[model samples]
Target: EIESIANHYGWQIIEQEIDKDHIHILIRYSPKWSILEIVRLLKQLTTYRMWQKHEVYLCRHFWKERTFWSDGYFSCSIGNVSKEIIQKYIQEQGR
Candidate 1:
């Protein structure tokens, strides 16, 4: 799903890891998109798809909530770090 979203937006996801509680993604996005916008769109699109695909389970667990992702997100610029290093970190996050 993440890959599909990235592709749809013409962004490249170099690496990604989904841990039990969090996710790490190394993405190369266009300058037109801000970090906040990227995160918001991802969470929104994925949440809607997930809800549609797994409505019963989500409703059972989140009876009072309508959101799947938390309101907070962490994003960083690739200023000093190399892309390889970031990709390695994201790949290792699930280990």
Candidate 2:
């Protein structure tokens, strides 16, 4: 679902992982897109899709109305390091 959404928005996801509480993604996006824009769009789409498919489960676990991800997110520029290194780091996040 996330990959599809990223593709739809023209973002290339190098690596991703979803743990029980959070997700980690390494992506390459166009210069026209800001970090906040990418994060916001991803969160919005994922929240809507998850709610559509798992409303009952989400409500039971989250106990909140229309909430999937947290209000805050962490993002950083991926310069000064190889993409492979970043991809490996993100892929190993849940382990």
Best by TM-score: 1
Model 1: lDDT to the true structure: 0.90
Give lDDT tens digits, candidate 2, residues 22-59.
88899889999999999999999989999999988888
Question: Cα RMSD to native, each candidate?
Answer: 0.9, 1.2
What value of lDDT does candidate 2 attain over all alpha carbons?
0.89
Residue pairs with backbone atoms closer than 3 Å in model 2 (clashes): none
For each candidate in turn, the TM-score is 0.94, 0.91
Which residue window of length 10 is worst by lDDT in model 1? 86-95
Error of 2 at 8 (Å): 0.7
Which residue pairs in candidate 1 collide? none
Q: Judging by lDDT against the true structure, name the best candidate.
A: 1
* Local distance difference test values of all predictions, in order: 0.90, 0.89
